[model samples]
Target: MIETQDLRKEFRDGRTTKVAVDGLTLAIPPGRVTGLLGLNGAGKTTTIKILATLLRPTSGTVRVDELDPLRDPKAVRHRINLIAGGERMVYARMTGRENLWYFGQLYDVPRAVLGPRIDELLALVGLTGAAGTVVERYSRGMAQRLSIARGLINDPAYLLLDEPTLGLDAPIARDLRRVVARLAAEGKGVLLTSHYLAEVEELCGHVYVIGDGRHLTEGSPAELTARTGGHRTVRVTVPGASPEVEAAVTAFAARAGTVAGLDRAGDGALVVSVSHPGEIAGPLTMAIVGAGGTLAGLEVTEPSLEDAILALNDAAWLVTA
Candidate 1:
């Protein structure tokens, strides 16, 4: 596990001091993808840098695979790698293969295995054909792919991906996501930070939401959303309803207390937003039935992980403000 306890990091410029990370306790276990979520300047990258041994925490205990990054940065570096989106860690003049070979050699990957490892990684990241191409000639997406290849050269036990998919087109982003999942499945502890909430929902088995450098909450996406009782939308096939039936259903909904909004979907289905779908689903169905509307189907869409995290973050800031 990669873990931190009451982690704190600060920067001082002249007489002014800025706290970038504050009292954040987090854990990323192996064999799973853990999401690190926060808005801009929420200390996400700073926290990652600390764990990656690129920045020392102002005060805290950080351990990567039971190795102290502060006390033994060299050992920590061998076991962990941090890849940040929009950050170019490659040399423009180096060919993709040369970049990998250089990094592999740095990690002491043996001469015998280095060649095969480079070939395998090149294919893994869709860079095989471009292996001999100078990195400066590669597009942004291809360059980002090379970063992934570079990060994996050491086959570190822990991978920290901060916005790994940022700015890439959908197809390329998806390919990288698969690579992340594959790494975790191989028991590499993976900590992913991305603004793409849906990606988090799909990939991360657990999530840590941070705000203003504070650990706001942690849970599986479903658990977090359930805890929030997230805004839900229930769409029912109220097909071929007459004006009278629609009016009856509206009146019934009003009397049944309330929901956030009610409207017709493009297919003329009834769509209703509610704070508590569990309490309202039955009444809604009955209303449609009594109003003589055909109910062929009903589906409740729960609020996304993004909604839960943002709502919780807003609440926390409101309390502090």
Candidate 2:
């Protein structure tokens, strides 16, 4: 539903130009949550602003549902809802319900549609209890909840969320993720940007990781993990392990595939990284036992999206450095 081809954005300072986004080419599939991940100042915000028609790109093309955000800004804006940093620009004097109702009116939603839209948004964001309270008295999380409600006021086909859960509590963030997932499942396209790796991994079907103002990688979370050789992180806890047993685990991990790295977490536990996951369990179990260590737990975990993105970011930095 959202596509960018060679998208670039630049800013001019005194005597130099800084590129905020560079040749970013990516797509967000309809009815799925596609996460846009990057460290702070890594062009994620720039890209989202361009796609939302709030900022014009320096070069290249961006289309949201076949309408150019730069050329057909009005049409694109009508079809998308862009919420950034949760409460960035919400009016403090209005009540939570008032905020959504105002947005619904701005979208020119029918008078008949406004009441239900406001009610549904308030309920969806768990702000029904404070629907009439002015936003100035609301806590940070409450205001954020209202912002989410505002984003849904028009029921736009595409939702562009930039750091939607950035500073919220764990419970609040979890609620927002569930709500966003539900929207995507209901056939709305969602493009999300987040630093919380677990949140992205849990909610996003595909992820586009960016660094150094460029696209580092884009694929399904599993696909990116597999591509980074990051899927085979194994955590093994043994009752007691001798030096020989540690050496054996290392050797077995090497034999399993490429040994990316290894570390020990706590008491007699070893975390090993294998490039590929195939046949890791049987060999590692045999090796530990053969070297006089009783296996306590041998569990395999896929590396998280954060880990994969950091790896990709490191690789991108290496290329430019």
Candidate 3:
């Protein structure tokens, strides 16, 4: 397991001091994927670097598998691997097979074991056929696959992926997600940082949202959405709707602590906002009907992960202010 307690990191530039991470605390246990999310300049990369023992924290505590990284940097490094996105970490002139073999050797894997491990990793990342191809000839996605394979050369127990699918096409990204899921299934503790909210929603069993280097919230996606006042917009088609029906719908929505907006479609449909749609759907339908309005159609749209994240950030700013 990897964990931190009140972790803090700062940078000094002559007369200016900048705090990159402020009292951040989180746990990444084995056999699951934990997502780290934040906006640009939010200290996400800095936090990852600190955890990897690439940079020492100014204060607070950090541990990997119960070993303090500061005092046991080499041991900690041996237990974890970081794959930073957009970085050309592979040797372009070497064959994909050679690159893996080189990294395996660097990690001190025995010659007898390194060969088979290289084969397995290439297959794991779907690069078995391209193993003999030079890294420079590989496409962006292929190089990324090789990068992942390189990171796993030592078969570390913990993996850190920063924007692993940053610039890939949808199909390529989906393939990478499958590899990530497979890694977790193999009992590796994975800490994934991505800007794709939908990707985080799909892959991460637990997510942590941070802003300005401080944690905003942490929970399962569903729990986070619920805590952020999960809402849905319900579009109700009510033809020939009278003023009484509109007033009654508006009043009901207000009582439920939701805002209501009405737009006259060519067919005269009313769109209503339901704060707690799962709980208010029935009542909303009844209210329109009970108010002497004929329902023509209804459509509901639920709050997305992006919406929940934004709400959390807004709440954090409100508190800080």
RMSD of candidates 1 onward, in order: 2.3, 2.8, 2.5
Please estimate how well model 3 matches the true structure, expressed as its whole-model Cα lDDT: 0.87
lDDT of each: 0.86, 0.83, 0.87
lDDT of 2 by residue, 239-298 (tens): 656788778877876666456355666664655545454656677777778998887776
Off by over 4 Å in 3: 237-248, 264-278, 291-297
In candidate 3, what are the lDDT values of residues 191-301, reduced to their tens digit? 999989898999899998888899888998888888888677777788888888889889988898776777788665665555564667778889999999888887887
Which structure among the candidates has the greatest lDDT? 3
Give the TM-score (vs. native) of candidate 1. Answer: 0.91
Clash counts per candidate, in order, are: 0, 0, 0
Ranking by TM-score: 1, 2, 3
lDDT minimum window of 10 residues, candidate 3: 268-277
Instruction: Return the top candidate by TM-score.
Output: 1
Model 1 score (lDDT): 0.86
Q: 73-186, model 1: which lDDT tens digit per residue?
A: 888888988788879888899999999999998888899998999999999989999999999999998999999889999988999999998889899999988989999999
Q: List the residue pairs that clash in candidate 3.
A: none
